[model samples]
Target: METDMTKGKPMEIIIRFAIPMFIGNLFQQFYNVVDTIIVGRFVGKEALAAVGSSFAIMTFVTSILIGLSMGASALFSQFFGAKQYEELKKAISTSFIFIFIVSLVLTTITSLFMHQIIHGFQMPMETREYAADYLRFIFAGLIFTGVYNAFSFLLRAVGDSKSPLYFLILSAIINIVLDLVFTVMLNMEVTGVALATFIAQGISAVSCAVYTIKRMNFIKFKRKVILFDKKMFKTVASYSILTAVQQSASSFGMMMVQGLVNTFGATVMAAFATASKIDSFANIPMQDFGNAFSTYVAQNKGAGNIERIREGMRGVSKIIVAFSLGISILVFIFAPQLILIFVKKEAVDVIAVSVYYLRIVCVTYTLLGFLQMFYGFYRGLGEVNVSIILTFVSQVTRVLLAYGLAMTPLGFAGICLAIPIGWFLSDALGVIMYKKIMVEDSV
Candidate 1:
């Protein structure tokens, strides 16, 4: 069902939207975690290292589409909130066309330059082979990823978060079953998991797009009007392209961090990969809530309820602090048990390093949460350049610190420490930027 977020109590409305979104995001992250676990346990630590390395590469490529769709979704919410039905339909059509073109470009580049991309990571030859195998099938499925996000984000923007979750749940189940069949029984190693993901996501993307177009008539259109709005095209492009750059810059920075982690060999690489996923998993609630907050703010902004947007931000921050603190305690206390889920018990070194990395970063999720909310707030308000600038600050700090600290005695420990520091630095900057923007708005 569609919701008008501009009406309800801000916190109540946000939690309702965020609950399903959080679950869906969890399942989405589950795709990668399941791959890591299956690859790590069945294949070996080297393969785990490879999967870890490939994450950065795939995130970089896929983020272009994800970011674009996200930006467009904000616009969707805004238009819907304002009851600009015609503009919403036209923008939807335009964004779908533009996202499709970008997906093709990414698929082409990733296909052609696959080896060079892996080589840049500086992993061992064995790990590179595994990374290459993993990335090949993943790249083949890039178009499906674009289709899925373009539609799912549209659904969320219109306040129908549950439908996307249903689609992800089914596809994620297929992905898990296929992961087992391909990697274990078929002995396909990294190739099996990648192929599983490729097939599973194709199912979700096609299904979601089909359902949304056929069933949701609000944004649907006659075939003739699709892609005809030149002005809306510029609006969609500004939001989508800037957000895409922000997302891509983030993944690109991680790619650099992956290269640095690779320098420490397979053990550290495997540990970082697994630990980072766990870190990502632990902190995903913040991202989901931030997204919900953005949607809330977007709707209110479109309704010209600036005061409600302010209230929504404050309410969302309280939720963030509560979620971040609780998750931090749990993750810190159970770091080893969590690490064991991904790798074998006999892989003592990998487990130890994973624990260390987690312990270092888990406590700082609050800082991460605030920074993420800042990104979402700006993006929702159509100030996507602010998001890009904030992300640039965060990513640059992370990449530079990882490399700089690598030469010191702290070594890999320094790399782990950089994660939270980057968040803190960005959060500080986010505060100042947000305050300035609010003051200007008041003026």
Candidate 2:
């Protein structure tokens, strides 16, 4: 049951697979960063701040979808390697059904409670209004995002990461143009930015769905084949719930950090918000590599090729470290220039502060890369509870440290410091767990 991926040199395999994922992820980031740039430049600082404030809340909603898709990927990749085509198709159909129902219900509930949810964080009124508006529109698009993510994950699981990347690239271009049309030409402000994102996501989702259905004969199902299977649903839910909790907890921690940023005034809040978006763009390569490893590990693990999994991981680790160091150095050298790309001259000081925060986090990107890769490895191996526990520990520690330090002489630096420190701690824990549990078991 050796797949084409596992038949290649490890480095060549990882890079070839990861390149498309990296490109697709970068395009996904482009969708968000483009919106941020357009809104920050044209819509005013407050509007930018508003959009930034919704970051955590939006992540909170999307996390469930991401987790479900990730779980499906894990199962599909493993079954794919095992040549269980029928099971893989069943998993895909069941996952699609699960994602649509859960995403719709979650979106409805979250939208209805949006006000209460935002207010619970105790953010400033100005920031809250903007956050609410941005969130309302983004939530409306969850169904599209969830479905697209499920399909994309399925594609990647079966060695088709490039298709999703192509679709995302096309959608991103369309999104950028729409951003100009809606925000710059029409002066629609935050609403326009939100609409642009929604429309782009919808397009990407549709394109991926159509492409997959048309090309992948496995996905074509009869009415009898599509019938619900409780066992499959339970397996998907079990993995997804833990992954979702881990993500939701991390998002909750970010929301707390956002609350702290809000208290500091709109200028600082906007600066932090914008910086986070920039940071997301910077981290995509490592994140994509992590995703590639997850699929690689899942498939190889199913094929009983643990040695190749280790080889793949080792190759990816080197790549991630080198890329992290290179990116960090470049970002440090061009911090101010990069900041100016998204913000105004008047907001230079705020942007500078954000850049400083990014540079600080950049110092630890290698460690963070390890953490991400190991988490992916765990998920691919169906060792999800360990991943969940590690995430909870990291988020809880981050919230406490950020809150306590912010109250001290450190202020926002305390808030910024929380990120790297949490990553270091989480990475250390992941390394220990991997060695003690996974490595030991494999040996």
Candidate 3:
């Protein structure tokens, strides 16, 4: 399944490549969606708010781990595309070793400060204990989370997207079954949901590691040949740290927005939580396309196929526009029904707030889609610093606007407006940067 994207028609190649990733991302969303639905329905709005509140914190950690893995994947794709097998092998071993060490350190730090972090967010006093308990177990399982992401991303880099998709499907199914048993049957509440995730992710991580070792030739980590190379480590780190910062920066901004919403009490928090999960789902096509396009770009860039990269970019934009428009229409029209999926009919305040938030954000999915694709293109070209700058600008705009607008007459609605405003600003800058790069390449 290792595809040579440099040879085919760019549009055909990208669409073919992107489809597997898009499906995989949908399955991947089961991690959050299952937990939200079960917890919201069985455990009540307070429990839902608890899990939702912890999302920003967990996202902050997941982003760093995922960013590092993405950096390593891009490196692998570049080398693989260039047909540099020896160096690629060494890079793989080094990246896995480095990420392992970082994961442990991050887990320890996050676990130790769990209380302070939740308190700092000014979470509702009633839900603080539930949120704290959920986060502790999640932090305990950070290794499984980090390892699975690393393995999955490495596989995708080699064009074996199907393998990871299969594994993710298996893991998601396991998680959902466990969610039903723990939250509904046994009434374990937040604790049960967290434990279910930990077990499912652990299984997936072990399965992926075993498969990777047996199947991937370039990924086998023989100690003698795998000794750290200063140059290679720096190359990987340089790419990873920026992306890590970018992801964490965006998560941090969302954390700020979460804090603003928390001020309005548990009803608004529950509303934001439900809308955010739905929002995450709505953005899947955008994210998956960006991911697919990034891998495509990296491989083509490695092969020095500039024109093909541009071709793929154009092809991806059409898909983005179509998916964006289509999803926006559905979500906009069915916002209340979508909210009802997580909340009960009696929870009128939660439903109303969630619907209002979704309507405001879903309409702007097109802009967000554009932003993600451009970010992927930049990252694929190994212009990660540009990607980081774009994230910073977007996050900063969101934080400043969210805080500034939250106090105004618009209140919570202002906070929602800030989401797309950030997207528009970032997309504008991203488009400018992308065109500049293409123009320079032409010259």
lDDT of 1: 0.91
Best by lDDT: 1
TM-score of each: 0.98, 0.96, 0.97
Residues 1-443, candidate 1, lDDT per residue (tens digit)? 89899897899999999999999988999778999999999998889999998998888889889999999999999999999999999989999999999899989998999999888779888888888899999999999999999999999999988999999998999999999999999999999999999999999999999999886786657888776578888999888899999999998998899889998999999999999898888868999888998888888889998888888889988999999999999999999999999998999999999999999999888999998899889999988998998899999999999999989999999998888889898899888888888777651
lDDT of 3 by residue, 1-443 (tens): 67777787877877777778778778777887788888888887888998998888888888889888987888888988899888888778778888888899999999999999989998988999899868888898889878987888888888777888777888899999998898888989988888888888888889988887777864455658766677788988877777788778888899889988899999999999999989988888898788888889999888988888888888999999999999999999999998888888999989999999999899999999998898788888899988888888888999999999999999998999999999999999998888888886641
TM-score rank order: 1, 3, 2
Candidate 3 Cα misplacement greater than 4 A, ranges: 218-223, 441-443
lDDT of each: 0.91, 0.81, 0.86
Question: Which sections of candidate 1 miss by over 4 Å?
Answer: none
Which pairs clash in model 1? none
Model 3 lDDT, residue 120, Cα = 91
- Location of the lowest summed lDDT over 10 successive residues in candidate 1: 434-443
lDDT of 1 at 416: 86
In candidate 2, which residue pairs clash?
none
- Error in Å for residue 49 of model 1: 0.7
* Alpha-carbon RMSD, each predicted model: 1.0, 1.8, 1.3
TM-score of 3: 0.97
